[model samples]
Target: MVKAAFKVRHITQRYLRPPGALKEKDFIGRCIRCNQCAEICPNNCIKFFGSENGADSMGTPYITPREKACILCMKCGDVCPTGAIKPIKRELEPIVQYVEMGKARVDEQLCLSYQGKSCGVCYRACPLADTAIKVGYMEQPTVLDACVGCGLCERSCIQIPQAIKVIPNHLLASQLKATHLKERRSGDNDVQIIKFK
Candidate 1:
């Protein structure tokens, strides 16, 4: 079991996961999931959880904006002595250099555009120097195929609420799913739906 755990950690690290592939940034991203960011959050936006996902990031933590968007509040950043989550002026900087997040996806079924109305707020809001998100004539207006799931659409949606969001990579999310199945068979007990607590 120890060897198996080591292998999982080694593989996850091998992937050079998180904080992007930029080596310079990874230096600041060696987070041990200490929950400092979550704890310091006044808005209770940052959240973490035990690894029901896999041995790799088992007990690993992630931040879900839905708990509360960063607001660029800087509480997490100020408390992050290790610089795990950087702080920046919400208006002046990109906040999260979005491209580093991952490729974006537009679920047509859930998207307002696909909801039979021509709402193109996302395209207009997306910062378009090398626009990762854009609009195209898809017989129905659809987000450009080049979208990098950066949550911009979700953040900028004006449909009385958000209509888009950044999402974890489909392949990675599936692998975690498989890990869950494996864990269930091992009978370590209790499966609970994790919430953003």
Candidate 2:
């Protein structure tokens, strides 16, 4: 049971939806797997899962940021037949406001800048620059809330194992939902539970 649970978790974390993706359940249901999203992607970062990611995920478009991060052209969303990937504008504000693929996290131990070497590659790669990521002394990168999780920073990182990574929004959403459920079960009568999904 433990091994099966771990495998499920591992499979869940293996991929991320395109920008402006709907919630996981809704996306899986709404997406027709028409391959339109992958077809319109200029960066060629989008790929489909086979039986490896399970039946629900089969043919669903996903992005592997380490291989190629999204350029935020917003083309994939524009081409999607269903609302699974909502059409977001190519402008900075709309993209920032609507797109939520994942959030980038920096591992200080593996980061060169954090280890006393000056490296600002991630910061340079960020489309939002100072708004999404900031660099301090020795070019140590700091991720900010405005980050749309475009994954450019992670892709640009110089570390062998990648000092920075994007935690997919689907995973974060699931965690948030779990926490909400746990809180509701705690028997707090006045605590208003907000629906995330």
Candidate 3:
């Protein structure tokens, strides 16, 4: 019975760790699992909870875009005084995009665009101008097609912490297609729509 219990414990540890956490452990040996990352996140992207997975994953920081997304604000990683959520230096890679947490999505219901509000915070803050995020709509601002995943909108969002977030590109494609389909259903007339603001 003692031997069997020990074997079960060993197997449990082997399988319970998260794949996302492997890189973190490879570099740091083990995380302190401090809540600092969650506290400092500008977009409140960090989630720490316990589950059937294991104790290690429990209360450990991970980002979920459906809940919140990393803004490339780097606050969580940077504040990791322990270097767990490490940042790869742009100087070292040279050509990499720095941080690609994911693509940005506007929840029209949660967005000011649907409300006809006059907030250009996201459009104006975007570094790539129209190439990154553009403001559409006749009077209200909506995002036009060209988004480079730069994350300035995620940063500038005034929602406590922030409403906009960076998500992985894999998830965005299907969501983007669906959003476009909804626009088509509404007869938005993309051909004649000209957005300057």
Candidate 4:
């Protein structure tokens, strides 16, 4: 059972939630599966997981940036009857601070800019622009702390395998915890423990 659970976690594709969504555990409990977030999304980026995704995820709103990246309009949160998705203002500061959909990671080897092709599409597509996705040396995208993981960069990426991807916070937290435990058990000195709570 433990091995099966670990295998599922390892294989599951991390999905970005709507802006202002609570942590996975809390969101699952609070969400009423009303589909309000999906209906209110102006960009129509929010979609519910089907039965094949499993009972826990079925009917929960998730965004696949490859299909449609969030524009960060905050309308989904505004229409949420429950606080599963917290209501946030449509301002820059609040959105940056409160909206943590995921974090974007870049694969330097596959990036066009890193290949000397000078691609800046990801930087240009980012709504936060200079703050979230900045163009660094050789026009390479530098994801900054201001990134709210709206996945505009991933959506705009022209790379075949996608040079950039957003790692959902829930999955990231669990992975980090697992790594920390593994490192602790091995007594690895280089391990940087990060507590999720």
Candidate 5:
């Protein structure tokens, strides 16, 4: 498992797996490289990794939000024969609670709203709307912790460099693990060790 994790850590691109995807190592191990998830996608958002992403990642389904964003139809999970992508119900509450594809982050410097242009495209595109993201003065997007990172906001952003982007969950998980380890080493014995099963 540790060796698998080391390999997973090397695929450094900020790409998201399908909704309800397992942890990186487990996903790679469990996924049979079948393209069923992509076939059933109503939005046609799912794409497969080529040789560039590595052999372990070859044919693995991923979504590039900038090009096309998932509609959260939950069909990908339903078609996954392997549990790499666990089946999630096509319900709002279940989707919010279970999906951890990533979290949306806004780049204020590149945002039109921050520049007083009153762009609310991202806010209007969000499926979760006010729950996952809130718009304040000038409709500047404020990402909440509840954001499941479905990538619609990033896709809808009209900025040249994209004012909003989804930071993949694997990257976030790695950062969290590093922080916990650092805290543990710095005599913070109170820090709990989170096991990624």
Candidate 6:
């Protein structure tokens, strides 16, 4: 049972939460596990973590973009009783500013466009195409700062191992913490050594 549980945890790591979700820690605390977000999602992309995920995260809604990417309908947040998913106005500016579920990254080596194959499906699939992703030289896709991590690119990629993927914000948050620690340690090591002359 423990081994099976571990496998589920490993698999769920790549899942993305709905847009406007709070930081992982805060979201877990505030979420009521009511499944309201999942129920209200027009695209039916939201799903609950099951027993295999264990009690820590069981029942909390998450999305597996490989299965069904979010359509950015902005409905899930509006129906959430708890503020785990903060509601944002259904407008491009608000969605761009507040709905950061993750950031899309492209693996150039695996992208057809990078190999001169002329594939730009991922770029075309993006809801925020011009803003979030742009076709660069040779048609290679370039992720932009405006990306809301909707996973549309991932869903549309034709590569065997998806060339573009959404790196969830929870994972990004951990990476930020690790980077901060490294910076702090280096700063402490550089503390000026004053020797009384």
Tell how far residue 2 is off in model 2, in angstroms.
Answer: 19
Query: Would you estimate the TM-scores of all the predictions?
Result: 0.48, 0.83, 0.41, 0.88, 0.86, 0.83
- Residue pairs clashing in model 1 are 51-59, 103-148, 103-149, 104-148, 104-149, 154-164
Model 1 residue 146 CA deviation (Å) reads 11
lDDT of 2 by residue, 1-197 (tens): 54442243422564678999987778888999899888888889999878566566678888889999888888888788888999998887898888988888888889999999999999999999988889997898988888888899888988999998887887766766766787778856555432221
Error of 1 at 19 (Å): 8.6
TM-score of 4: 0.88
Q: In model 5, what are the clashing residue pairs, if there are any?
A: none
Per-candidate local distance difference test: 0.46, 0.82, 0.49, 0.83, 0.86, 0.81
- What TM-score does structure 6 among the candidates reach? 0.83
TM-score for candidate 1:
0.48
Displacement of residue 116 (Cα, Å) in model 6 is 0.6
The per-prediction CA RMSD against the true structure, in angstroms, equals 10.8, 5.8, 10.5, 3.9, 5.0, 7.7
Most accurate candidate by TM-score? 4
- What is the per-residue lDDT of model 3 for residues 81-129, given as tens digits with 9 covering 90 to 100? 5666564432313212444334455655556655677676766766545
The better-scoring model by lDDT among 2 and 4 is 4
List the lowest-lDDT window of 10 residues for candidate 3. Answer: 10-19
User: Across residues 56-90, which tens digit of lDDT does each residue of candidate 5 receive?
Assistant: 77789999999999889999899999989999998
* lDDT measured at residue 70 in model 5 versus the true structure, 0 to 100: 88
Q: After superposition, how far is residue 34 of candidate 5 from its true place, in Å?
A: 1.4
Cα deviation at 156, candidate 4, in Å, is 0.7
Q: Which pairs clash in the backbone of model 3?
A: 102-167, 102-168
Local accuracy of candidate 4 as per-residue lDDT tens digits, 38-110: 8888899988877545566668899999889999999988899999999999999999999998888888889
Give a tens-digit lDDT track for model 1, residues 1-197.
Answer: 76664343322321211222122225224556667766776656555544433444543444453333333344555565565545434332353453243344455666676777777876765654134554556322344434434344556666543555554443335545766886788765455422111
